[model samples]
Target: GTYPLYDITASPLTSGTHKFDGPEKNNPYRVLGIDEKQNYARFRFSGERNKRKLNVEFLGIKGEKLGEWSISENDLKTPKQ
Candidate 1:
């Protein structure tokens, strides 16, 4: 499975929404929004048949990885509080 490439290095650290096409054509991943002040981000994946693992990484300004985690499909199905 493949994932879309998103580079935000040059972008300002401001809250905003984004959209990107998934690896498969017609499938899209929507970034609902990012709250810089709250340090939170929300996204939606619209690929039902995609069984690939979703790995998230947090990087510092210098591009050093601060932390990382993997989100399973089951986790995505859980309702938000």
Candidate 2:
């Protein structure tokens, strides 16, 4: 399967660089939810908050880390449930 790539360090959600240092074949991320209005996919990181949403877009796909990207709290936050 193919998923979007997003930088989790350039946004307010994080303050440093985050790289997936494990095997690229392993899908460590679980699809938590999705936002249609924003066209973003939410993924939950291993050992992270279940509610912490990481909104990202489909910027092509590969078997490696696409690039460095950080999503801001604002970008992940929705107006209402």
Q: Estimate each model's TM-score.
A: 0.33, 0.19
- lDDT for each candidate structure: 0.42, 0.35
**Model 1 ranges with Cα > 4 A deviation:** 1-50, 78-81
- lDDT string, candidate 2, 12-62, tens digits: 222333343345325466232221212222343433454444444322123
lDDT of 2 at 68: 28
Judged by lDDT against the true structure, how good is candidate 1? 0.42
Backbone clashes, candidate 2: 5
Candidate 2: list runs displaced more than 4 Å: 1-62, 75-81
Predicted model with the maximum TM-score: 1
Q: lDDT per residue, candidate 1, 46-68, as tens digits?
A: 43575545655544445565444
Give the Å error, residue 25, model 2.
31
